[model samples]
Target chain A: MTRAEAFSEREVAMCTVARMVENGRTYWAAGGGTPLYSILLGKKLYAPEAQYVTEDGVIAPEPMLPYEPMMTMLAARASYRALAWGTMNTAGIYSQLGYMDYGVLNTLQVDRHGNINSTFLGEWGAGGRRMHGPGGADTIAACCWRTILITDQSKRKFIEKVDFISSPGYLDGSEGARERAGLPRNTGPWRVVTPWAMYDYQDRRLRLMARVPWVTVDEILAECEYKPLLAPEIQVLEPPTEEEVQLLRTELDVRGQTTDAAGGWIVWDGEKYIRGGGD
Target chain B: MTTVSEPATIEVLASGTAPYHKIDPDGFREWVRDNKQRALVPKLMTEKEAVQKFVADGDYITYECNYLTRGPNSLLHEIMRQQKKNLWIAGKFTYVDVGMLVGAGCAGKVDTGFFLCTPSVRQALDAGKLEVYEYSNVIMTMRLEAGAQGIPFIPVRSFGGTDGFNHSGAKLITDPYTGQPTVIIPALNPDVAIIHVQQADKFGNARIFGTGISDVPAALASRKVIVSAEEIIDTEEIRSNPGLTKIPYWCVDAVVEAPFAGYPGTVPGYYASDPAVVMEVFASVLRGAVEPYLEKWVFGVNSHQEMLEKNVGVAKLLDMRKRETIRGGLRA
Candidate 1:
């Protein structure tokens, strides 16, 4: 027993995913869709290569326009494939999934006048001038994985569900039922990354999609008060692509997304630890 | 670190209730004389040399459990690692692929590399260094289990309906009623299901408790079964504690015990893995990368004992880790 060994091939293998990507990375974008944002941002984070698949199943890195939607929320109604958040390049390149409070913000907001806001990755005060819109370190980081949020005419307020988004991070409690359950009511496509895993809002329920490392698909399922018709994979998760890793790392570098960064804006816990365990 | 006159015999308990029994390798050689079970094709294999010889390159090897402690320098890891398309995973354990993904920057095919297991495991994938290929066999298994349990397509709204749901491999079927598509996970029937158990008897009933995966299905779905247990008690005791029994005796073809079976593993009750040693390896990775660390930790080892002899046990590592925690960081 005195000479026994610690650490097995199996155990080490489990923790390596979190360790693969070192810190110090950043993602820059005007917002296209969630998957694309994730793919590009993931590259900065994990430093891994990527495999880009076309809508037709042809794997490629160069899909040009539709994936870069003018609006935030979108959905591929037919394949059931969605691009509610981040940079998505699927089917016909629709808006992220979103549902609005008033009538429906289904009408894409055309800001082609180019008044779009620009988010920064450095200190809150490091920006050149005064803040124009709602965005900070992670707010921008969220953009790496988040694409659109259907908002009411009110600038500060936003809706929860997109007619469609890429990842289901938030819900559309824009209406009254939310207060009954103590849920945060929103007016636009709101977003959140629960400790457990990735979430996307659809019709009504929050679908538990991909999970972070160390998190169980069930753990997320249990926490999600609302059950969607679908759930994420039961397994922990497949590893990120090489490019995705690189993207996260690069973004972390520029913005400093780590335990030591952002005044610990995002707290690390048992749930979040699942994604970046041993970090 | 000593070599025996013959490879030591091991025992396997079925479920938790079944009593232990001895598995005679010699008798096993004789029992398999006719090779009647050979017709099924050897799926689950032991670390034994004979079993390794039988495994072919293209076989779909499904053994959910990764003998953490045993795998670093394990011949099976070596064998499985060589194959670009060997399906050596299950619904139980899949943390094994993290290192390769990080080191290689590519998680091989889903079936080839460590696929899906738990949500925590999924986190590592999303973080990167764990995902190489993109196939939804994971959703396949969950749905398959439900299907095997006699349910229509189980509901799963994950992978974000993005490309994941759109993935041809991820989608199992299209829903006719809702006019919405339903993801279908085709039943996974692996060609082989290999597991390292605590013990086994001549008849074949076996069991263990770490993470309950679809061993029953893995065995039943596969054509052949290979049982490697740590100990094998008499058949009568097995009948006494039938509650723990997982596999029936008739299904197994070979029985052998390889104690410390899940070596290099942090087996809850059976073994301990040195956290410091892992930290030691990772310290190197922190200083540089995983390749040198793997080269030394993985390739430097000549045998399991030699590897053990080179480091301390997990308890000591835990103590060191605790002390280091108090110290804040490890000082060179």
Candidate 2:
């Protein structure tokens, strides 16, 4: 596939997440990679009225640029009064805050039960192959009204069981497990958006709900480590509209930071999408 | 668009066991119980002496700073320079500090919420040279809080849906009061906790601006606390503005006055993260040239003062200072 075709996966993922974002609901975007882009796109296009609670606990209604350097500078420029920690304790926000309505996150591995793991791969502590640990993902998964997980589809990632549970989804595929485990009843994994397909938990098990245009059910099943429960009425995911693509290229990521590979640049010129240009 | 028959039964993955399971909680409880009776006077020391005196081989140490600000970079470099081996480092949202320690082969085990994947650290993990345990940021913070509060454990709502519940050392318990299942993380008491602050007195009363992150809890949870400060003020000044003091002197073991201590990272009110240097280090690490980078920037220089002068240079430092001033002394 060409870079442009490969870029569409990102576009699809971001647009799918953008569509889920509701206006006036406070949403938390945690990771710096794809989820950051999704949240940025959501703010720019669909959820302009949505409030954002930054990792450091600053609440801003205005869209804060997701770039790290820019975010740091913006936080500083806004001052303490504008970007106060407020009543938000780091743990408290994750556990008790009712205002944190939605969270968009990325994880390394997922299972049929929507269990996500970004921690270790082998044994715990001594013999494990360490991956990046759960940052705020555990809290967000356990506490957010709804959580959307985004990842690239691969057999190793789409497994029967995660090596470790970095964040809880549905435990044991049983009803009331989340509530029984002391998670808020209304809070749990809501969607899983991958490069090939989208999944939703039904009957507390991950069910394939949609597939991207070019992907086939056989191909997706072949790529998954376990047999995924297919939805009765699975549908093809609608590709991003021309205007959505245009906004994504021209407004959300004008510099082509997200879409471009290292040393390769793709930008939307006034009339057409172009590659590698000074204009 | 396809439909498939539901599998007759789903197999649940059994939760993995943790290494800490062997550690007797009663022993830790006894240690905490004994420590509460003892009083400590804050000592004044240089960064070198503090690390040398406090940090030991196989010690579980922690430096509580997020990726953004107030990392004890100078102290961590000192630990690297000292070549303290078999050390277990704990952190929440660690970036360069943990990365460098793992890169330098100084860390034996890492207990952290989030760690950046620097090439050397990744290689180490791949090679099974380092042990790692994971927790969510809030879980780790609450664990430290449990230690600070002299409690054996604290119940939390996290890990319910996470694979972390299986692998983490945390226990699943039925809340006695409510009968709801809750995760209980054991108290995490580090051998030493090193933290950077905007200002600290000789008495070790430290003042941290901005978020404060997990520094206070980390300090209180540790057996010994080292305060690395941008400016060492008088005790009178700390007393005058008591609210600014995040970690009290009673919790602090030593105070080390080290300006530009969190270089490459940032100390709020002092400077912003040096992205150019960070990129340079990152590039070197990626290219498998970290040894030369460290040799020149860390070991080649006698001290942080010399390292700053030779590597960061006068111009960049002055520029950073000016930028901090323009930003109203807030880190960007």
Clashes of each: 160, 11
Q: Report the Cα lDDT for candidate 2.
A: 0.70
Runs off by more than 4 Å, candidate 2: A1-8, A61-83, A86-93, A120-129, A154-156, A179-182, A195-197, A210-279, B1-16, B21-43, B66-68, B117-119, B122-129, B161-163, B286-288, B325-332
TM-score on 0 to 1 scale for chain A of candidate 1? 0.30
- Tell me the spans in candidate 1 whose CA falls farther than 4 Å from its real position: A1-279, B1-51, B65-93, B98-108, B111-140, B143-160, B172-181, B223-226, B249-256, B280-294, B301-306, B309-332
lDDT of 2 by residue, A158-271 (tens): 899887777888877788988776677777788999756898887878889998656689978897998888999889876566656676776556555554522223344445
Candidate 1 overall Cα lDDT vs. reference?
0.33
iRMSD in angstroms, per model: 20.0, 3.2
- What do the candidate models score in CA lDDT, each in turn? 0.33, 0.70
**Tens-digit lDDT track for model 1 on B163-243?**
223222333333444333333433444445565554456566775532333455555544345666656766677777787
lDDT by residue (tens digit), candidate 1, A1-279: 011122211122212223322233222222222323343343434444433321211222332222211111111211112122111122111111111111101111111110112211122223222111111111121112223322112112122222222222222323332222111223222222222343345543344455545445555445433343354353344333343334333432222212122111222353442223221
Candidate 2: residue A159 Cα off by (Å): 3.7
